[model samples]
Target: MKGNVNSPLHSDYLNNKMKSVQRRHSELKHATPHKLRHTRATLAKQAGTSIEAISEALTHSDTITTKTYVNASNVIPMAVGEIAYRNLKK
Candidate 1:
């Protein structure tokens, strides 16, 4: 239950809380909400989440904008190699 609507948690409060919680962890030195959001988006993309789904989850008006937000690493090289091998074998 929100005790105070006037005192609702905002970005600064969330950022401060994040800093306080991560103060002891040197590895999380640059953990801000923006970075965390991007990381989540990237992870979702890597986990095979559809761009349209990601866009809706992120509340983006345009799917193209969501495409720019995701940072996924995949196996294009391996797929290309397999295709080449199949073509060469025929």
Candidate 2:
């Protein structure tokens, strides 16, 4: 699964790594590259990261696609924007 110098890691490599992890951790049996990406996006959203930032981080051309990655039901109850703003002020 090794890639040539300067080349991106193949999806198969990541998938294999994920499978190995799942073998060791039964709780992660449902994990996959796409699921991991979605989880990261949701976490970033819950952490008060701007949607545009998340979209850019995910290399999405439009926020609409990134929106689907975020799990709205898992959002924090606090004001995420306010928390982010306060962090910026610090």
Candidate 3:
């Protein structure tokens, strides 16, 4: 609430809050919302989230754009055939 009124939080307010928290916390010195988002995307990709899903979550035009946020190299492509084969083994 901006100045005792109900309202959406602005980016400046968020940034200022982030800075204030960072000042009190030594480990969060370089942390920002954008970096946290990128980290979440990368970690989600590493945790087996599909590129399509990630793209949708990020509201990107396509998966190609999402690839930039996700660590592409660490993501192993699991083809449909491979998934089928794994399921058959089980």
Q: Which candidate achieves the best lDDT against the true structure?
A: 2
Please give the CA lDDT of all the candidate structures: 0.71, 0.86, 0.76
What TM-score would each prediction reach against the true structure?
Answer: 0.65, 0.75, 0.62
**Cα lDDT over the full model 3:** 0.76
Which residue pairs in candidate 1 collide? Answer: none
Q: Show model 2 residue runs off by greater than 4 Å.
A: 1-7, 77-90
Q: Tell me, by TM-score, which candidate is best.
A: 2
Off by over 4 Å in 3: 1-9, 73-90
For candidate 3, write residues 26-85 as lDDT tens digits. 775587877766877887776566879988877789888788898667666666776667
Prediction-by-prediction clash tally: 0, 0, 0
- C-alpha displacement of 27 in model 1, angstroms? 2.8
lDDT of 2 by residue, 1-90 (tens): 255654566799989998898889987558888998999999888878889999998889999999999999997845867776867997
Model 3 TM-score is: 0.62
Question: How much is the lDDT of residue 33 in candidate 1?
Answer: 84
Least lDDT summed over 10 consecutive residues: which range in candidate 2?
A: 1-10
Question: What digit string (tens of lDDT, one per residue) describes model 1 on residues 17-81?
Answer: 89887887767567788777677777666645667888887778988887777764541223556
Query: Lowest summed-lDDT stretch of 10 residues in model 3?
Result: 1-10
Q: Candidate 2 or 3, higher TM-score?
A: 2
lDDT for position 78 in model 1 = 39
